[model samples]
Target: MTDFYTVRVHHRQKGTDYTLKVPDNRYILQTAENQGADLPFACRNGACTSCAVRILSGEVHQPEAMGLSPDLRQQGYALLCVSYARSDLEVETQDEDEVYELQFGRYFGKGKVRFGLPLDED
Candidate 1:
């Protein structure tokens, strides 16, 4: 028997709040859609931050959330598309760009670009 946890989500962009009964074994985003919650998502494979959220309370397990860094995870960020509820949870949707910047901004536009490659001929 699967244990069910109460999942509360605050969609900051849409200014909406949803409360759902999520099973411990099922992905939260999938279960939310199944329960008629209109949440945002892009890649369902946990490779993107489109479904990112910040955990306000409770625990979530997202082993496949490659989009989220270990430090971010430690800071309570989760990718809902690949996350499972461990306990009753309350989470607020995150700004994807903000999360992206925090996760990878340092790696972007850092050094001088060489534009003399074959594909970069201008």
Candidate 2:
């Protein structure tokens, strides 16, 4: 028998909430979208933070979510595009820029730019 879990999502920016019956084997975001929920996503393969969410309760398995660091994941962050519900779950949509910043803000403005092509150096 296939197991199903209740997935509740709070879209903070849109001030909306969605409740979905998600299969344990299925990706949460995709299932929600298939059911007509308007969730944000980009690079659905889990390479970006556009679909990032904060797990308010319960757990998810996101082995393919490469966009998030281990620390972030441990801190309850998840990339919904690649996350599978592991239990009845509650997640809050995060601002894309905010999550991106938390994920990579340390590297911003820290590296020197080599503006010109290496072969065209003056």
TM-score of each predicted structure versus truth: 0.87, 0.87
* Clashes in predicted model 2: 0
User: Can you write out model 1's per-residue Cα lDDT over 1-122, one digit (the tens) per residue?
Assistant: 99999999999999999999999999999999999999888999987788899999999989998777787899999999999999999999988577787766754465422341112112
lDDT of each: 0.86, 0.85
Q: Which 10-residue span in candidate 1 carries the lowest summed lDDT?
A: 112-121
Deviation in Å, model 2, residue 38 alpha carbon: 0.1
Error of 1 at 113 (Å): 14
Collision count for each candidate, in order: 0, 0
Off by over 4 Å in 2: 111-122
